[model samples]
Target: MDKSVELLKLGSKIRELRMAKGLSQAKLGAIVFKDQQSIHKVETGEFNPTYIYLLEICEGLDITISELLDFKK
Candidate 1:
């Protein structure tokens, strides 16, 4: 897979999880100590989040890294 495609898929997956939990970007950002714009960037694949950042996102979403990265579903 292309790197851009992978990033897009990761972004989409995060968006899906956020929506499933009924959390807005602003709200989730608050939980993760990020701004809404930052969350938007992540969800749009405009940002390449670091491992620690991903951990924070997963924590905010109440999920494990395994769950977050398990795109096989």
Candidate 2:
């Protein structure tokens, strides 16, 4: 798979999980100490985040990295 496509899928997963948790981008960003714009970029696949950044998002989502990347649906 292409790297951009992978990122887009990851972003979609993050958005899905965030919505499931009833958190807005700003709410999740506040929990993770990121700005809403940054969260928006990630959710829109406009930014490639670092490993730690992903971990931070998982933390804000109250999910493990495993859960975040499972994509088993």
Q: Which candidate is the best by TM-score?
A: 1
| Tens digit of per-residue lDDT, candidate 2, span 1-73 | 6988888888999999999999999999999999999999998888999999999998889889999888774
Using lDDT as the measure, the top candidate is 1
In TM-score terms, candidate 2 sits at 0.94
**lDDT tens digits, residue span 1-73, model 1:** 6878888989999999999999999999999999999999988999999999999999999999999999987
Local distance difference test values of all predictions, in order: 0.95, 0.92
**For model 2, where is the 10-residue window of minimal lDDT?**
64-73
> Which parts of model 2 have CA positions greater than 4 angstroms off?
none
